[model samples]
Target chain A: MTLASALIRAHIRERLAAALALPIVALAASSIAMAGEPVTIRIDNFTFGPETVTVAPGTKVIWINGDDIPHTVVSQTKLFRSKALDTDDRYTFTFDAPGEYPYFCSLHPHMTGKVVVKAPAG
Target chain B: MHDPTDPNDDPTRPSRRGALECMVWAGTGLLWTLGGGLPRAVGLERALAAEASPAPFSFLQISDSHVGFNKPANPDALGTLREAVEKIRTLPQKPSFIIHTGDISHLSKDREFDDADQILRETGVPMFYVPGEHDLLDDEPGRAYLDRYGKGSRGAGWYSFDQNGVHFIGLVNVVDLKAGGLGNLGAEQLDWLEKDIAGLSSSKPIVVFAHIPLWTVYPEWGWGTQDGARALALLKRFGSVTVLNGHIHQIIQKVEGTIAFHTARSTAFPQPAPGSAPSPGPMKVPAGELRQHLGIASVSLVHGNEPLAVIDTPLAG
Candidate 1:
């Protein structure tokens, strides 16, 4: 083939690869932004690990009961509540607003934890 | 270890000594008499022979059945409970009634309640009930427990009745618990308690029973009632007051002033002693030793003449 034709074909191929790569990178970035890291509050030994958590609004928070006994996540202000969570059972809630949410295990009320949800940076 | 010089140890409070005496009596299989508010350790042989002469009236205390619990600590919770019931059935004298101080079910399932009721009913003695945190685990909180046991009971299945000249009050303190606190008897229940005991003369013998220990046992394990002192204050006027509780699943007896507090063993599994383990959960024992950790309680009242007697009998040696 002629050198000029070969160079044109190589340029076309490079442009096509860039076009596909840009969307793929953008898609990955958007997905990461849309679904932020989910915060987990573990229930173990009748206590909540990290007793307090700070998260951005719309963050999904999951509570897993790792103790042999059952536990529950109940909001102090009656905003959300969970059914009894047996061993290895999980309950999840998403915080969509900026507020301090305090919760505890209803059965073992001494176990308490707080979630501080803040708005994204300006 | 207990410090004898601790200010918290009131001079008149001889709980440690009393408990030791009680253990000595129980160890010998002797029944002591509590007469005129004083405990007199009867001779072992006479006490054994005196079993034929039963107390005026007595009731059985069975607690923490946890019927639906199927764990390594105890895979057959119901089987142990039935064994406890059989012990009750074959008692030398039939108890006037039975007091089940809660945890009738593990997950608050209807089937668990039914199974417990069927097995417990074989004793053929009337029963009084108060709920435990485990029993209130239904989708709607205490719906399952209340539906079956709330009849004629005031808020959360607390009530009072007079039997054999002794006033019996069942208090419910396992609901509406506050964050960072232990068990709770909210203001409403406390109000009911005040009015319920009003008009009764100070000489009246009072028996107060609840699911959780009315006095502080182990706050770290959530084994105490937040507002229990208020209730005790109300009962302070009585000449003789006995408080029976069962959530801790072990026998712990304490006598403060005129009031005597007793916690009973479980018909299900055993829990670690306060601060004995990192956390208070079921303690798994060897399969053959499970029954040694589980048992029942018997409370006797010799009409209005004697101080109350509580006998704790284990299922096995």
Candidate 2:
């Protein structure tokens, strides 16, 4: 092959390789998206804003108490306990297991909320 | 009026006068001891304490029990809550009613609610409740809480009633909470509160109860109500206003004008003070003092010509 043709052939091969890598990169990005970032729940007054949260396993659930009073981010199934958060306090716990974690304010037994952890789809 | 020369007055001139003076002195001493000094002896500091004993009308304020919680601090919160009820049952004076400031169930689950109900019902005291953020975890705000305890309340379990010359208001502030926001008493509730207290005379005492603190105890952990000022303003006209809350799980008291805000301790577990820990969570104490740190608040009402004295006694056991 002539030098010019050989160079073109090499360039095409490189382009093909790059094209093949795009799918792999896209797949990785999508998986990361599915895994989701940490979910932040702001606890104030007597209820959790964004009462129902959807996240994936390995996602960290951060509960921030912004009320002037203290509160708790307690899981229904005994999954985790953020003892009692005072004003501007925060508690973060990762959900490695996939399931619905319901919680309530320990101070006010009537106050309740939940977090749902989804598993990674195959 | 008898002559001094008579046997009654002449022989011992000081006899009758001295005897009468002595009798008068003894009478005065008896009055001071039995009538005036008895109240003081019993440690009655305020003038109103002399009126009458608080006719045994008491109510329970159980806060931050954090049911549905499992941790080293309190492995079985529901179990401990049952213990608290047992303690209440053994009280010399059983409270006529119970008020849960918030956090009735940890997870807002049917089972959690069921467990809390089973445990709480053991007390046999009529219970009233306000929602905590955890109680509003469902898709709808306070759906489970309202389903169980929000009867006769307005939207989201905010309501009011009259008992023993006091106006009691239960407010819901956890709904529509802002980002990085403290507790919120939305406009609707604010209007309602204003109207609720509008008709009451200034002499009438008002008790406003909620799950979040109406005053700023700590802002970082959302300890104060976002629009509590508005609520206080409505209560300004009242002679005595007591704002009771439970989300803090600790005892913090503040008085503003006619208003007094008190945050009660959690029966479930104790948390560190604001900024004490990196974040707010259960603080494990020695097993012995756990119950002491966490207990119920007893508010006794004695209706008389004076302001109601709310004496808060933490659970000793």
Candidate 3:
């Protein structure tokens, strides 16, 4: 093969590799989006299950009351609050910022939990 | 009126051991009567005789009527409450009025409150109430309770009423509870309490009732109030002070100087004593033994220097 032909082959190979990398990057982006899928914290027996939850930023968190009694979800700093949740009732909140948010049930204050939102990986 | 037995004479300083010992004795069939600031445990026969006798004016106290609770502890809460009211109706001497300490409803739902109201009204006795945490679980947080029972009450439904020369103060301490803390009366309610009894003479008999125990019974289960001490301090100057409460679902009485503290049992169900269970909730007894744990309280005020006589009558024991 001549130098011209070899140069063309190299360019084609480089272009092919770049094209293959595009789908891999796209798959990674889709997975990152999936990372924000909703998380659940169950309220049962006057307790918050899993007590503490860690999720990525922008992830949505849901609290479902499983006890026969009513409960409430109120943030420590008054950032978010849910009305009294009867049995099987649900409340949803999204953590958009990377920080620690602690909350408790206003009705039964002993039931407490925390949410830790992690920064996205570089 | 100060109890010479209590050296400190501080109403706020209660002995937890004394409270616990009293609880154990409560399970027996004996009834308690407070005379001259001392709780005297009498036989069931003598207590019945005392109840048959007359006094200046007697009132009934029914607490924790969780009308909507359908748990295994007691499947028919409303039915049991009706039974309690039935007992009230059949009393030899009808109560002048009824003082319901709190937890009138289970979930604070409209139907729960309605059911409780319907059953309690059957006795045809005027009722006074303080809100429990369960009664304030509505979406608006205590709006349902206040709307129905807050007529003349101030700031979360705390109010005072003069009944037969006794100054009755109904306090609200279940609102604005702090996280990981017990019940709270808040600064606003505390200020209101101070002024509510400011003009009353020290000799005037004061009866303070609230849902949660104003003194620390057990903090692990959130049975006590965080700012309850502040309110008790305000009442320390008064000679004849009787603090009645419910939420523990059992009888635990204490006497410190001129003040006497007592917690009434629930009309619906019973709860494990302080730390007996993993947590605090409806505790189920064996079959045919549930009534033994549920009951009502009757208090009699004799016109004189004699302290009020509080009688706790279980549904069955």
Candidate 4:
């Protein structure tokens, strides 16, 4: 083949590969956005399910009261405290910085859970 | 859960209403006791002949006003509580004092406390209060409640006083609780309670008032006290010991010889019956029926054979 034709062919191939890679990169970006999405934790049967949860900083965490009685979400270090959450009620807190958070139901002291907030994963 | 009716249940881990149901099936009422050194369920015969000797003095118990609670179950907790206060004032016989079981506010806010205090002052009788879980939900632990009602109370707001020949013990059980659990009387308070009644004679009439039920009403709803059994043991020998509480927001009476456990209905709103709902939260009864379930507990101290007689009067009829 002529050198010019070969160069053009290679150029076309490189452009095609870049075009295909664009969607792949976009897909990965969306998955990362999904990773930063809010997570929900269930509080039921006098327990905070998934008692230990790890999430990226800035991710919002929601706690839903599934139990019959009223409950409160109080952080160990005074980080946050929710009002009495009745049945099906919810309390949301967004972790803005990385730290370990241990919390419990103020009403039912036996029901406890922890949250681990970490820097956004690369 | 600390159900006295079920010996099989674990003292630390209380079960469902199964034990309470058992009390019904056994032909014995859902009554648990703190009479003698042990706990047992008693019957109607166990009821002291309260009328045998006419009552000399009386006290009122009102609780859970939740002044800021604007939820559907009670749009105007303040209004209902006002109704309760009116009922207290119009009692057939004036009570010597009033004991508020607790939950005086919904969010422990200054305004809520203010509203509760403003209205409660109308009773024109001295009122004793022990904080509820709701009352302690402020920025500082019990700072608001203590500021308003903790005067002359001991550590964390617990105290004992004598009135009309009856030893009244106001215990603070909601200071430190288990995670999503019931009320707790820590070691310090327990110690104080032990010494408070150490010198009293067996014939002395005693009255214990707290925010949560001393007996296990329902574990699932955090209605009982974790260390209540221990606290109650000290009063077992007294001939006329009455335990009054209010957290369950319902009327439940039990007689165990001289020690009678009675939980009063809330002045604010009604919660679901034990195990009647999916969970224990507020219940929105038909608008007109609210008064039937929400009211005050009037306990009469008749200088007679019976130590105390508790008559629960609803807000309406």
List A-chain TM-scores for all predictions.
Answer: 0.72, 0.74, 0.74, 0.76
* lDDT minimum window of 10 residues, candidate 4 chain B: B18-27
Which ranges in model 1 have alpha carbons more than 4 Å from their true place? A1-34, A119-122, B1-52, B303-310
Structural similarity to truth (TM-score) of each candidate: 0.84, 0.63, 0.83, 0.75
Q: Local error of candidate 3 at B303, Å? A: 4.8
> What would the per-residue lDDT of candidate 1 be over residues B1-317, giving only the tens digit for each residue?
34566642344543322322222112224355555545566655765564454555667788999999998999999999999999889877688899899999999999999999999999999988999999999878888888899989887888999886678899899999998898899899999999999998765678899999999999999999999999999999976688889999888777788888888899899999999998888898898888888998776544222344545678887
Candidate 1: RMSD over Cα atoms? 7.2
- In angstroms, the error of model 1 at A115 is 1.5
Indicate the docking level reached by candidate 2.
incorrect
Better of 1 and 2 by DockQ: 1
- For TM-score, candidate 2 versus 4, the one ahead is 4
Candidate with better DockQ, 1 vs 3:
1
Query: DockQ score of candidate 4?
Result: 0.31
Clashes of 2: 59
Would you list the C-alpha lDDT of every candidate in the order shown? Answer: 0.82, 0.69, 0.82, 0.75
Considering DockQ, where higher is better, how would the candidates rank from best to worst? 1, 3, 4, 2
Alpha-carbon interface RMSD of model 4? 3.9
Number of the candidate with higher DockQ, 3 or 4: 3
Worst 10 residues of 2 chain B by lDDT: B22-31
- Model 3: pairs clashing at backbone N, Cα or C within 3 Å: none
Q: On a 0 to 1 TM-score scale, where does candidate 4 land against the true structure?
A: 0.75
Please estimate how well model 3 matches the true structure, expressed as its whole-model Cα lDDT. Answer: 0.82
Candidate 3 regions exceeding 4 Å error are A1-34, A120-122, B1-28, B33-40, B50-52, B303-309
